[model samples]
Target: MSALIYCPFPDREAARAAANTLLDRKLIACANLLGEVESIYSWNGERGDSFEIGALFKTSAALLDDAIQCLAEMHPYDTPAIMGWRCVSVSEATAAWLGELDRGG
Candidate 1:
């Protein structure tokens, strides 16, 4: 199965940096930046809103955990919102590509 990781970065530069790191490490096959988005949430007993750059990472299920862990460690926010999950249904060709990507295929 394939996996998807959704994370919001502080800015475009940060998002690009993180995406490149993930690619260089072979943690993700590709990443898509969704531009700026307004995020509203409560943190540390306070509620606030801010604009963030959204990113989607494509990878295999085998690398999802490692990818998320690495991203969390490198993220700028004290508690960045990183969401990941295995895809319930993915085309055979795409799944194969994602798996092969992690193996440097």
Candidate 2:
């Protein structure tokens, strides 16, 4: 199975650093960095808005747990946004690549 993980970073540098770390460690296949996303949400019982960099990572479902943990450890947010969604469908090549990664082959 494949999964897409979403993680938000405080800034572009932070996002780049995290992406480099994960990529170096082979925890994720690729990370797509979307710069300066406007995030509006409620926190501490109050509405807040901020500009954050968003990174979408593609990896295997089996690696989701480790990937989330890695992001949590490396992220600057007191409560970082690291969420996972199932990649129930994907292109054939992408699916095959995820499978290979999961098997570490």
Candidate 3:
């Protein structure tokens, strides 16, 4: 199985750093960065709003746990938003690509 992970960073540099680290470690096959996203949420019984950089990572389910651990260690925030979900459907080519990535190809 393959998975897609989403994480929000305080800035683009941080997001890129995490993405590059994951990629270098072969924990993620690909990463897409979304810059300057306005995020609104509640924290500690308070409403908060800020701009952040969002990143989406693609990898095999077998690597998800390790990838998450790496992200947690590399993340700047005390509680970074690191989320992932199994991919229920994917093209044959994409699946094959992910498989190759898992094999370090």
Candidate 4:
């Protein structure tokens, strides 16, 4: 039941802040932040390109909703790109760690 959530922020600081908030709330087990990434997408019928900080959060399915809520509350962007999917496969250790978080360990 493990999942990986992807959140893109306006900057590295914002990403870090959101990640820290999620961690503090025990909504996610781990977060890996990519300091710089170029994102090209169409918003409001216009093509836009910008640099962003991408964060990957590891957690269990049970915490996915909480993780998304944390991101929405802490993200600086008016509409943050918060998306995720259930992991099809994961190492036993990683799954165990996520389970521990689920158990409040």
Using lDDT as the measure, the top candidate is: 1
List lDDT for all candidates, in order: 0.93, 0.86, 0.90, 0.87
The residue-by-residue lDDT of candidate 4 on 8-81, one tens digit each, is: 88887787888788888899989999678899999999999999888899999888888888788778888888
Candidate 3 lDDT: 0.90
Better of 1 and 2 by lDDT: 1
**By the lDDT metric, which is better: model 2 or model 3?**
3
- 7: Cα error in model 3, Å: 0.7
Worst 10 residues of 3 by lDDT: 96-105
Each candidate: RMSD: 1.1, 1.3, 1.0, 1.1
Error at 16, model 3, angstroms:
0.7
What does candidate 2's lDDT look like per residue over 20-62, in tens digits?
A: 8877777788899977799999988999998889889888888
Which ranges of candidate 1 are over 4 A from the true structure?
A: none
TM-score of structure candidate 1: 0.93
How far off is residue 78 in model 1, in Å? 1.7
Candidate 3 residue lDDT tens string, 21-52: 99899998899996678899999999999999
How far residue 88's Cα lies from its native spot in candidate 1, in Å, is 2.1
TM-score of 4: 0.93
